[model samples]
Target: MASRFTRLTTVVPQLARGYAAPAKTVKVPVTLFGLNGRYATALYSAAARQNALDAVEKDLKALDALVVKDKGVQAFLENPTINRKVKLDGINALLSKAGKPSEVTKNLFETLSENGRLDQTTKVISSFAELMSAHRNELSLVITSTKELDKATLNKIAESLQKSGLSEGKKLLVSNKVKADILGGLLVEIGDKSIDLTVSTRLAKLNKLVTDSI
Candidate 1:
């Protein structure tokens, strides 16, 4: 692990080395750009190379949960006022207290801190998860409605989506989000595709059509 970390650190100074996608079709297919994307891609490649992908995924998911569940932690990651050394110390302590974090994950935290990229930690985690999902051939289904969905409603929506072949042989992961501004109806997003049936969108279309016809 130390050797691998050394290699990563040595390679990072080259700037263009770690951003390359793995030379396999089954790896993450999406082209990630920008600093967050490059960091996520590098992490994905390193985890894959070390055969610690599953452990890294679990570690990241756990940390992601902490970020979501604790506002203080989220603020700590996003806090621009915090100095790099202070933030790095806090993050190392947090990860040590949490479940076992893989060497790859720990190295990633260190790299982010060393480069003053801690503010983008949340985005990096999210992008890494996206890469993981693609590698696992998982499909994400997000339903947006005016109100929070009950379990039964969510189940029904999942069942309906499954029957409609939305999964496409990939595992289906469903989530619901509430957006009161939509007023009514559902807005469904599957991967890169979105179906917007919200009342607001329909009303806007109607208004546009009526004005155009006039």
Candidate 2:
């Protein structure tokens, strides 16, 4: 039994590396269900086995797009009164029509239905995709901005950040968020440390400068 467990562990990551899709497909990190993130790891293996990581990613992306385009769909799917059969049918129809999700994705939804966990459908799919992406060595980034950043400026930001003392020239995880409250300037957060370049902070500094001059 110990040997079998050892063997399984050895082959899991090998499969994960070979079967996972490109990292660009999933935006957020996946979180597993109760106890440990075992279910998430298993789903990653399944996708890896089928070499359907990208396809499954597309399936999840389709769902994500659907949720964004129709804000009410998530609530409707989660609503308790909705019959399981109806929900399953709706899920299948949605994925099939999208024509991008792999068989693995369909099977996952079916499993969720069997367990009466339709509410977790989106979460599970996201988690599975994230696992696959991580195994592929991709870093997910979150960016915050006061307004939409043009592509060129974004490129500059990425290039400038790569030169920062923290990055030391390594490629980084980047995402953008917009907050009007920043007033002006930019705040860059990479991992634990956040560099504040906001206008409010600048004003505080300037105020200190005047006090010091006095």
Candidate 3:
């Protein structure tokens, strides 16, 4: 286990070298924690130095979609029985088939494979995306409703959020998710904060108030 961790530590610098001449220091746009965060931070730093942040992000988004759509790819990454070398080769082949992915992106998957962390691939990609979004000054906004929202409605909500200072200067990447359990109204999530306006939540609050009174 110690050796595996050591390999993981060393791979980051080695991958960094494969990119452009190392910057004196690369600033991570956001703070992230945990193993996935560490890997994502390292990849972000390397990509930032290489000026390939967009390319690496594009590669990761494509890979993430592929994993979602391809059960075989999902199985390959999650399979613990497969040896590291075979996983490495499989990653290489998969990247090859994906058409020219950035070297930084390739290095990320290769390092993950070598360190037997392929099962964390999806999480790492998500972490990397968070970093990229931060880098681009983008904020995630999710609106939960009982039905899918039209694009115009989403845009209007985003604009309102921005005007209301909830979004402020950040660019909002808005998405809507349907949840019948919400009952009615919207559950808006802007970055880490949530404004719960759902009828279910209001009803629950009213019930709690009555219970306390009783």
Candidate 4:
């Protein structure tokens, strides 16, 4: 399956030939790592060539919602015991009932099914979303604190980051996540870089230093 996925990644343009526009290279906005990243990048390139990025994204969002709401669908995807052909048929039927999704969207699912990667549907969708976000020049900023931070604080942090050149001329999408284990301080993740200022991390470092001395 891994080898098949690798091969599929290179030939994605061929798979999307019927649906996508004339053969032309479409560069991805950001470089993602791993198998899912490769799949997502291929999908993005295909969608971009087809001029159906928004449509494909909408279809994937709806599919994501459906998977979250329907445990049966979720279980079916993760069940490796199910035949790939059966899964492919089931997915096609589901997509048909869900309305006419763009050909590029359908091709994505078909490729996943054929490659025995039905289980990776969710991850692929997420990675595709990340590509879309990057395509739109949106930088994701995650702020983790011991408790929920107010909007004012979040905005201030985002503004500060922008001034500090962390935004790199991109729009900032700020989100706050609460992690009580942090005890105090904040952990900021902007794009691929992270700044750890959590009390827990400081204490751990101190403990390690003391142990080394002892």
Top-scoring candidate (lDDT): 4
Off by over 4 Å in 2: 1-38, 164-173, 191-193, 200-214
Preferred candidate (lDDT higher): 2 or 4: 4
TM-score of each: 0.79, 0.68, 0.91, 0.88
Give a tens-digit lDDT track for model 2, residues 85-168: 899898887777687567677666665565566776667666665576565655444556789788788778777777776664
Off by over 4 Å in 1: 1-26, 163-166
TM-score of model 1 (CA atoms) = 0.79
lDDT for each residue of candidate 1 in 81-106, tens digit (9 for 90 to 100): 99988997887777777777887787
The numbered model that scores best in TM-score is: 3
Backbone clashes, each candidate: 0, 9, 0, 0
**RMSD to truth, every model:** 5.3, 7.9, 2.3, 2.7
Per-residue lDDT over 68-181 for candidate 4, one digit per residue giving the tens place of the 0 to 100 score = 888899899899999988987877777666688888888777778767788998899999999999999999999999999999999999999998877898999999999999
> What lDDT is reached at residue 50 by model 4?
81
Candidate 4 vs. true structure, TM-score: 0.88
Which pairs of residues collide in candidate 4?
none
